[model samples]
Target: MVFQCQRDSWARQFATRVVSCRAAELRPEGGGEPVRGFQPDDRGLIGDVPVLRVTRRGPEAVHFVQAALEPGAEVLLSLDWERRFDHMQQHSGQHLITAIAEQMFGFKTTSWELGRQRSVIELDTPSMTAEQVEALERSVNEKIRERVPVMVRELAADDPEIETVRSRGLPDDHAGPVRVVDIEGIDSNMCCGTHVSNLSDLQVIKLLGTEKGKKNKINLVFLAGNRVLKSVEQSHSTEKALTSLLKNGPGEHVEAVKRLQSSVKLLQKNNLNLLRDIAVLIARDFKSKPVQSQLFVLHRKEGDSEFMNIIANEIGTETRRALVILEQDPSLCPQETLLFLTVGDEKEAGLFLLAGPVEAVENLGPRVAELLGGKGAGKRGRFQGKATKMSRRGEVQALLQEFVSHGSPEA
Candidate 1:
């Protein structure tokens, strides 16, 4: 049987054959026990291949290969070399950093995770100093400059070399030889994940910063190789945009933003004082009119419902008259129209009295709501609702005017 390996700039594809086929279970990370009622199909292969997809079980499971093949059927596999290479760079850089940190300062690493844009290693310490991070970065880069060879060795579990290597405990199911990755004169670790073949293959590792983690662990965030380049490009683009928008040098962007914010606050304060004066004028004009009917209808084009409510309340307190306020619609359905109602009345005692009783306010609320295709509620003689059908504003006003002509709730 012939095996074909196809190479490209982004990925590598290959063809292999299935050795065996069976069912398998997938295990969850950090789940101490296996999950029940979950199983997936698997196929066995004679050659090595990288995994890209996963089948999850309920909560915990085991990993298995998935392929559609008989004993000797050909299988095509596609591997993303760009992603793999980036992972290798990051994983290799992490090994060097972890080893150097432990050897020089005796700081033990508890755990580590390789993220999409960055990676983090949790140090088993309460905190890390700035000087320690700088020194660790310097040492890791020194190893990269030396172009140290990375060697892989597989030895039996009882071999003498097994006793000398560093490991984070073997799984209970491990039955075969243990694979050890040795970085020349730097570190040796037992890892299942992939890595670069040489120290210089990492390119470089830049320590971004650190943060406090669970159980007093210090998480060191860093970027490796291509991720570092991408981060720098993004930051440069953002700085250029900020400089252009602020019309200032990169260094002065923060000061310019602060000045703009201060100017905005001053203008906002002035506009609020102007709105209060306008409310007073609107109230005086309504009170000057001699219409003493039980209901007053008015429509406004400017200001929101809240602003209009302020002017309506001012009219109520100044003239102590019942009022209905709404937005005048210049268009038809789908434009928002606001409706508000308020009445002047004294609080009546005894349990039989109606709450917030206003003849037009109570009777007109639901009718106007139907015309507006919405609902309204009120307390202390005031009601408000919003309508999407702007064309019904005239119908709402005509109903209120009809109720006002009869002069009572009974009418």
Candidate 2:
């Protein structure tokens, strides 16, 4: 059975008598457990009460209401005209594009979607060239300009004329006559969606371009009617914002951004070289000490992993009794601190370069990490990981001191 929406797409206000009213659970389109009394704010009104949603149950139009009503109550059902018109424009535009593509280029449309902001039609082709898209858009708008009539014909289920029109197939529960929408001298297809009466009602169509689809198909995206105008306005606003920020015209925005990127890359390269030099100096100062402490700790607010590794490699070559811990200051990263730990000793620094006591490192590394609210792993006397609580660095330092004094983490 054809619903009122399908029969008359232009109808904004519908007057009808309620057949029945009952309380029931309704599941949202985005599948979930059934909800009771789901009142959506954007729904239309049934007389004084809001219509939560409307769905098709078998051949009947089921209206989900927020409140109970008498079985024979007379109600005025009003449609959100703006939204309905948008849907009509997109739906009709899809039909036009599908017909033209199939007629002109043999690119048959497999399916289509009338999206909230824009619409898409899936063509059974591996890819679509920019030239083809341009041609299709031109032909579609030409038809709209000509103001071609869109006619709807209801045919008997067993009618021989049904075989002449394009159709996917009838639903398993579908009954009664078949509805075919025809674009004059263009194409005819079986459809149940609401659409405009004339091609001119589509206003204009803007082909946004194409996207790769599954199973060797191309999804062509487009904006119809008011959507095309809105898209142009949005693009112009974005261009103006970019022009102000880049201090360049819209045509030069891309070039200006490229130049800025190049400058940033050069500055980053210079910064890394300076950081390396600083790492070398820091290591040299520690090694120059006549009598070095058994443990060396350093924290730098701006140091990265590369800088930390450089310092570790430099100081690691000569110190046999020292254990070094480097921390990337956690102030900038309130939730986590990057830590690097290395034990250096000339005796153990052989082919594998085993830096210090393996037992001491294995025992202290994990314990230190735990106290700082994190986990770590290491081998050959080197450990590193991220810690959540850098404020407990003092506790980690104390643990390191104990390990150094007793030559074992347990002490």
Q: Write the per-residue lDDT of candidate 1 for residues 1-411, one digit (tens) a residue.
A: 001210121235556555544554445466655432222222122234334234423322222543323656676656556776888788878888889889988888889999988999988888889999999898888888899998767777788877788889877655556778889888888865567778888888899878988887899998888888899999999999998899889899889999999999999777767766776686577567655334445544434445556666665654332221223432321211123432221121100111123654566566666666556676555666555554555565566556555543232
- Badly placed stretches (over 4 Å) of model 2 are 17-43, 47-54, 63-72, 279-304, 311-411
The global C-alpha lDDT for each of the candidates, from Candidate 1 onward, is: 0.63, 0.75
* Model 1 misplacement above 4 A: 1-13, 19-52, 55-71, 267-411
Worst 10 residues of 1 by lDDT: 345-354
Give TM-scores for every candidate, taking all chains together and pairing residue i with residue i.
0.61, 0.75
TM-score, cand. 1 vs. native: 0.61
How many clashing residue pairs appear in each of the predictions shown?
Answer: 5, 1
